[model samples]
Target: MRTVAARTTALAAVVTAIGLLPWLSGKDPALSVLRARSAEQEATEEALTAIRDDLGLGSGPVALLGRWADGVVHGDLGVSWVSGTDVLPSVISGLGVSLGLMGASLAVALLLAAALSTATLVRGARGTLRGGAATGGAPAAMLASVPEFLLATVLLIALGVWLGWLPTSGWQGPSSLVLPALAMGVPAGGLLGRLVDDALPAVFGERWVGLWRTSGVTSRRIAFAALRRAVPAIVPQFGLVAVGLTGGAVAVETVFAVPGIGRAALGAAKAQDLPMIQGAVLVLLVLGLTAGALAHLVRVRLLGPGLRDAALALPSPPRMRAGRVARAVPVVLAGVLLVVIGWGLLRDPFTVEATARLAAPSWAHPMGTDGLGRDVLARLGHGAASTVGVALAVCLISYLFALTIGFLPAFSAGVADIANALPPVIAGILVAAVLGPGTVGASVAVALISWPPLAAHASALVQETRAAGFLTAQQAIGSTPRRILTRHILPAVAGPVARHAVLRLPGIALALASLGFLGLGAQPPAPEWGLLLDESRAYVERAPWAALAPAAALALLAGFAVSLSAWAGAGPRGAAAPAKAVS
Candidate 1:
């Protein structure tokens, strides 16, 4: 009953929010429709009134919502404000394409996860916990850090254009699906594998495993059984992965020319076609909710009635302690970053040389030239101030906000739930509507949606730390609430949150890049990494280096974050800590 009520509340809230988008955007919907329908038309009150009345926009907000709700109940989704076509058919068709793509991507993710799990298990139980996991996690983190959009571009250039092994873009045969699926799958698989690997160590240490081994259970069978036991705990993560794949498909679809719901929604959002946007978003929302329910059902089947709700509870933090290799990796990355900055300071990224257009990598241009013949290395250097600098600023601001509200997560719990469910790209669109599409809008949007994770972490840490014996003793000793928070609570919460912020810095930068790539960030002639990649896409066949240079910069950033964060986040060097339940 509680589940049903919660879902119902969520459904009602989303529907009402969709109805209020035009009002919240502060854009004249009638004028927007006029522009979308005929860009040259002048905005007149008479014409505006006609459009408004025709679309029932003149009605009060309550009436408008009522009409929309009624239409939705009767299998009517209305028509697109821009295209003036039935919304239902287009939404359904696009949903089908997106679902097919999501299914393929999820299948690839599962296969990669299974392969990684098998390799980890094959190391034998003795070394699996300490040796195999520590070595395996860093590489997985590196792979996971490679953003899907960058991966898609690389695949298109190498596999599609260079080798001519597959179609570059479009919706045709099965060959068209390969690159996009791989692009979305690889990163997801790495994260999933890491989570599963974390869970498996706990099962291996269980007493039943040794008992089963002594009772003549085959080692392979025992491993398989352990996998079965570990998997149920993390089934929801796969569902989250599915939801992420769907949300991320917007960029992949734009890159690959897949006419999925994500692309359709993006186009609609760009045009401010409210009806189309709502319809598309509604479909995606339903798909996400459905996927979660299905995942829950699968977990139940895996465990049966007696242990259906039982899950492996694992403690958070320190999958691996600070090793020499971990410390060395970040230092090396920072040094390379300094070198790029020094080189960039000496060159002018904006000077266009028509004669050197699309030039390949050579000593004259270490990173080659873009389509406009702008030096790539210089742009990498100059763009750092915008791309990397903005990312750092955004992270700090997000952390501040997280620290402020995270102490009482319940206050923002509903908001966080909505934000987490919505794609970062969608957030970009909403921010663009209010602030206009540019660097500020993109940065604000990324920061806006990204804080919830930090806040969640802060909330968890506060809960865990507040329950500590030291904190309890201080309270009993007559420490004021303010002093406890300032002296003990804030310091405790800040440490983990800061480490988490550093770990998330790469992702924040990538989010900014994604928005830029989508034309929601820094405009052209800006030298931003995302804009550089976006421009390179046109002539990628001729100048892959133009793309690779910026990409390498981003990759190094991810490497630095993954390595140093591991060391910063490590707790104590001791036995694998006891597991904690997330469910």
Candidate 2:
């Protein structure tokens, strides 16, 4: 209770400090207006004025400062950059789109991830082939590699233009979001799969799981139970991903022609709209931090402390139950899905030679080639491969790097708190500007985005695991810190670390995809997803397929990765609490 109170007080202080910033910055509306007038007059005479005189106009700097201070005290976030506009409406509207997209993407990602992991980890259920795990895991790698714009473009072409199945773009209604959601959700689902896979193996090894098997509890029931237990830990990983989604909104919205805050931010960025950018960033920061705090609070409530020991203490049954194979039907089904999808992509198909040639459906063009005269089937294969390859490489490499660096400051609670306060996007933009954008820029962006979760998870894991008795016993035995960490600690926390990485996958995928869409990734003629969308803008009216196809593909791939990773992170019911509170 005391700790909670203290933390609450600290948060209040942060709020208060943020509130006082305008006043402290010497905002005076009357003086500001006077100065603005003087500057404008002088600039007109000198003919060198470049700044927007009308941006954030108010009373002089001092009065403006006072009102800002007063507003902060009264809980107002203030007006926006444009005249006669309240900032809150824009913030709220943008937030709604972002939240809706994230929610849909998250749901798809989790469901797919759960199904994929269950199939991959549970041995020999239905048609459970030897390489099921590899095939199932392949989606994450593929989806992560592709950018959202690319996926959306492919979807636009294949589903919208060719089939006329859905609307090509715009945010006036839900139909517009289908492709975007798919492009976003697929990759996320794939990423979540890793966590679910790793965590389940440990849960399956638990004594209670064995005991339950002996008790005649069905394998399906056991797996479901395990997921329930896993939720507390899994939720935080998703929360972090949610934060990343907010940062990624700009590109996805832009690609789909959705009028979300992301589009607004892009407009602001283009105009060098400083106040607008600051406002957008501030909103994003607040949202991210709020989500982080909420996740932390929930984890603390669910797992509390001493969860690791309880999980370890669960007893293994003497007589293991049979029918484990029978209960693994779901797992086998997922493996089939992976195989079918892979086979469809790899199987040889007919080709077309003439560009811009439209022909009746025939064996020669199974998927009916696109405007570029390339076989749609062939393009699909390459596109899927490219998308998944990039997603996996980026997720694995970026997460690994982040995990290592994040561990450094996590041990010190005070430092971790301070580090957590800083948002990664600010750093990412600065880095992007300096690097001037490319694969190198994407790498730096991923590294920056990947760091916070790595630090958060590593620190929390260390803190929680350190409290375990085995580690205490080792300490008493004079075990070296390095050995204890590498051998005892890391090994024990592998499940959680894997889960963290899985959960973090969606955000990383988004960041990579967004960068690509923004022309900061996979340069032209490379068939990059985002680049495809960027190029398709010219033909949105006449040939919406060019943009929609890549955009949809990107969204679907991302959604899949997020779902898979989330599923992997889920704990089984009756499974013990996570080694750490996964804040």
Candidate 3:
């Protein structure tokens, strides 16, 4: 009870601290509002002073926090400085839209995952499951790899342009939601299907399953039983998928012109509307926490008494004998990346041909032309390089930060917990606001946000290794602490760290794209993927290929990264032997 009380208190304090971040940002709310309103700057200083006074900007942090807390308690989220309306109502309305979209997407993903999982299981009985899974899952894996913006763009082009089946971008009616939902759900469904596929072997191998088999149970019945047993594991992963869906919703909302909280938050962040941004972030945080708590409760209720041990148990690593092609996947992906990078370097990315503006794909302009008549192929190549470069740099910096700080007592597990609670988009916005926008700012933001999770993983791996008997023996034999760390601890953590870096690349790419999409990264003509998406929107209907080319490149790169991460390893495995003596 005491521990629970302490934890609640800690969470409250953290929420309060987050609420106070807008003030610490040192942005003059009045000036931000005036600038957004495009008002004259000549008389703004006096107006800004009065505006600040009206908003109680001169009040100390404690007083401000108290007032904010009181408002929050009373269900008042303050007013949007930009919109000049009550923030709560707008947030609620946005939440409704987001919820509807999220629900639709999640349902589609779950249903697809179940169907794919069942297919894989049915194929298992024929002794061709491996080949079947590889062939069947390949497209899903590719779809899963595609970044959100690219996926949305592709769908919009295909459905709206080529086929003329649906409206490209709007929330006018029920028909409009289909493309966006499919774009958001398909990739997630692929990931969930892969997870279900992986879990099936263990489920089928369980001792109790033999009894069912001997009793003349059909493969389909056994598969359904296996699926039921796998639900607990799949549920927690679905929770993660939900989080990803929420994050991706922002970009999806923007692409489809959906009036959800994500789009509102994006506009707020871009305009530096502190009140709206804070309110949106707080709501998102609450939603994330609520979802996680619900997932935990469901897991506990479903798994019963064994839930505690299961939660604590380390995941087993992939075996060395796992297929050669699977093991070589990362290498193959790396080679493909090298080729793309080489192609990008050999081409001119900025040559404009005004005569070919908005042209379809042709021999002269292979991937077609943008609104400005710039070659889509050239821009795609350059964008691919930029995206890959930023992701790699962010991963490298984040890994180094994790490795260095992960060993420090000052950066504890609690710190990681708090950091984990903060959303990546919020972090990116804050960092971008402070540092101003560019690749450097985006990279810094991503690295800072990326490090905590990696650090926590590394810390756990180190602790697990340190608890082993061999380490204690080395210490007793008078080996220096430095030597032991160098020879044992570092080596033990290396594989996990590498795998984590590989896995993190796609997310970092997405973050980079998000920042770029928001105009917080590489500026015009830089050919960053997200920036291209933003720029191509105006020409999407006229020359769909303008957007399609960069979208395809971004998707392919992100997909390659995802595939490599999966092929790398299944994260840190359990220690080979127990730490304590068996005697």
Q: lDDT of each model, Cα atoms only?
A: 0.76, 0.53, 0.69
Ranking by TM-score: 1, 3, 2
> Largest TM-score belongs to which candidate?
1
lDDT of 3 by residue, 1-583 (tens): 3323433553685567556755656765467666655655554578778766877766767777888888988998887776778889988999999888988988888887877666667665333454222334555555565666677888888888789999877789889889889878887887777777666655555566678877887877777676667667656656556656766777788888999888887787777776777777677666655665676667667777966447432223224344787767767766765676566566677888788788898877777888888877777777877787888888888888787766773555556445544445555665555555678877776676676667776777888888999988998999999999999999888777767766767778877887787677888979887898889888777877777666665665666665665565444453121100000
Candidate 2 lDDT score relative to the true structure: 0.53
- C-alpha positional error of residue 167 in candidate 2 after TM-score superposition, expressed in Å: 1.4
lDDT for each residue of candidate 1 in 1-583, tens digit (9 for 90 to 100)? 4333444566667668776676667778788889889899889999999999998989866887788878888978888888799999998888888888888888888887777666666554433455424335556656666677778888888899889999998999898899999988887787777667666766776778778877888888877887887788788666666667766788899889899998888788777787887788777777766676677788889889898556655444335456787678888998998899779868998999999998988898888999888899999889887887899999999989988888786775666555555556766766665566789988888887777777777887778778889988998899999999899889988877786777677778888888887777899889898888888888878778888887777777767766765666542222121111000
- Candidate 1: clashing pairs of residues: 313-580, 314-580
Across residues 46-86, which tens digit of lDDT does each residue of candidate 2 receive?
23222223434334445544555565456454654334365
Task: Report how far off residue 563 is in candidate 3 (Å).
Answer: 3.5
Worst 10 residues of 2 by lDDT: 574-583
- lDDT accuracy of residue 509 in candidate 3: 82
Each candidate's number of clashing pairs is 2, 111, 1
Better by TM-score, candidate 3 or 2: 3
* lDDT for residue 137 in candidate 1, whole number 0-100: 59
Candidate 3, position 37, lDDT:
54
